[model samples]
Target: MTVPATAAGRWASLWGLAIVPLLLLGAVLAYLVATGGGLKTLQGPPVEQLKVSRVTLPERGVIQVHLVNDGPQTVTVPQVMVDDAFWSFTAQPAGPIPRLGRATLTIPYPWVDGEAHKVALLTSLGTVFEAEIPVATLTPQPGRDLFVRFGLVGLYVGVVPVVLGMLWFPWMRRLSARAMNFILALTVGLLVYLAVGTYLDAQEFAAALPAFWQGTPAVLLIALLTLGVLLALGGKRQPEEAPLGLSYRIATGIGLHNLGEGLAIGAAFALGEAALGTFLILGFTLHNITEGLGIVAPVVRQKPRFIQFALLALIAGGPAILGTWLGGFAFNPVLATIFLAVGVGAIVQVVWEVGRLVARNTAALGAPLVGWSTLGGFTVGVALMYFTAFFVKF
Candidate 1:
């Protein structure tokens, strides 16, 4: 029996695709063997790269740093300096750290609260790496007390404000078509700010990533992928269709943004910047209050049930708690950057959807798409977010 031409072609394609990766691996293996597992080096000056991944204050007068070796050569932490003065430090698993290895250095110094500090590490190869502490405070460890503290912070910053904003539902029911158009347009404005700000934050984290990671490109690609996927998921709805679905999508996008916010707050506290964290909480609380208005904009005509409201709040605010936990305990630059990118993408997609809704509403009411009310509402939304953002400075 002869195989069908289509089946034969499919098999050939699959086999050819499978062989590509094998060929790539074989090439790498050949290079590794030929170069004696990369031991044979070309003529060049010695290269050393180290990253101070984290700095923690375990207790008063105690400074701890986590370092990662990212270069081809082994790195040794021989000397440490604090405030431009040499300070002695003890490294766990003492000795040179091979490439991709990690080490923790413990230094005992009198670090004062609310004061800035700089810690520098000198490698044996005369290379220096620096980490900064903008404000000195105790880094909270994992415990019940810490959990409760972070939970409260997330609640105040992420959950309560969003829910409070949602309470505008009753009052929004009384608004006329023009007012509703203003609100939907305002939602678009808010989402635009969020998308831009979130992407900027992702870029900031991406800069801290190791060069090999190519963090900026990865973030951009991931964000674009996310935006495309979300847009596709929305399908081809009618211009004014899917109010309930739109509301949920808005909540989900805002939830992702809140997740990034929680991560920042948690990381700030973990890095011993309590004052900065507190200010973030205040700013984010005010910033997120408007988010609820966006969430309910579509459902304003529908009179969604109480349970729907609760679910919307939870959907929009729950990730923040999980983000705080991750940021405090297992924060990684790569992960943080990815999450921020996802948030940016989601917010951007939501902005597009909300804009469509606003346009549809305007068309239904025989008003110009970009009327005075819409422009005014958009301006108010952007201005509100921009001003509130002042309280949060990285």
Candidate 2:
């Protein structure tokens, strides 16, 4: 049960940096709330000016745009026009404009090329806002669309760590059996934390939903169904290398979680919340580092080929990039919940699989001891998750 020197120091430093500041921040926030200073800020967003921007979509004729309410008070967009021609907005701002939030409105115009378009926004506050929206010529770039759109947000935050971990597989495979077991145990700890955290996150979303279906049961069912899908995919009762199978399962779960993170980033930006988008990127980046270890740990004894390792990395990491794309332009709450469910199921299985692996490897007398030994790693994972999670809701 002795703690590894490296692991102990790492966790100690992380906890010190994470917990102390979080405590101080909590106290400060509490004091602010008590004094109603923070509450006043939440009353409304600063409404000073109105801003407009044209959104780029695949179709050139479609005029997609949005407005940001920069001032403190609320402004409603009743109607809009393009080039003196009445253009209907698909999704108009239904409610009052929040302090700094944006309202996306799509106006599908027969946009003429090489022509300037003027958009006149009619608001309820007796203000006529006129802005020129320039339509761009669409040049098709087939291969680089993803990188151009979502950029490296997903790769940096969710995938790069897995790539690096894959590179270190040689060293990982050289570790002693006991050390490998410890790593396996540590991976489980991380998954356990993620499984619990993801379920809580689901609850938060569900609570926000309509009162009709208490989301708890739905959430549990979604997770179990996803687990069933995984089981169905692996038709056999059991695999020869259970730990490796478990490794893939864990990687799948981590990928789904990372995708959720990417979704948060994309949705934030799509909603024109730059500050939140940046915070999501930074928070997920920290979370992904340890996640790479979790993805790689169980496969240490398998001596997987380079292509196999690459496939694992892709399985564990590619969804992050895809999620960013979906979140930015096509965020669907239903899909987000589905991914969360899949992640939960994967993690649930991993906790069990890892427990079995740890138990079977060690002598009967030492299984409990191994479990105890991994507590430090598990605590570290939870602590780190919290530290990053403080910034982003997920």
**Candidate that would win on lDDT:** 1
Candidate 1 — which pairs collide? Answer: none
CA shift of 32, model 2, Å: 53
Model 1 poorest ten-residue lDDT run = 36-45
**Whole-structure CA lDDT of model 2:** 0.70
Runs of candidate 2 with Cα error greater than 4 angstroms are 1-147, 207-216, 228-238, 364-371, 388-394
lDDT of 1: 0.86
Supply candidate 1's per-residue lDDT for 248.
Answer: 87
Give a tens-digit lDDT track for model 1, residues 119-226: 999988788899999888887778998898788888888889889999899999999988989988888888888888888889988988866678889889999999
Output the lDDT of residue 296, model 2. Answer: 71
Per-model TM-score on C-alpha atoms: 0.86, 0.61
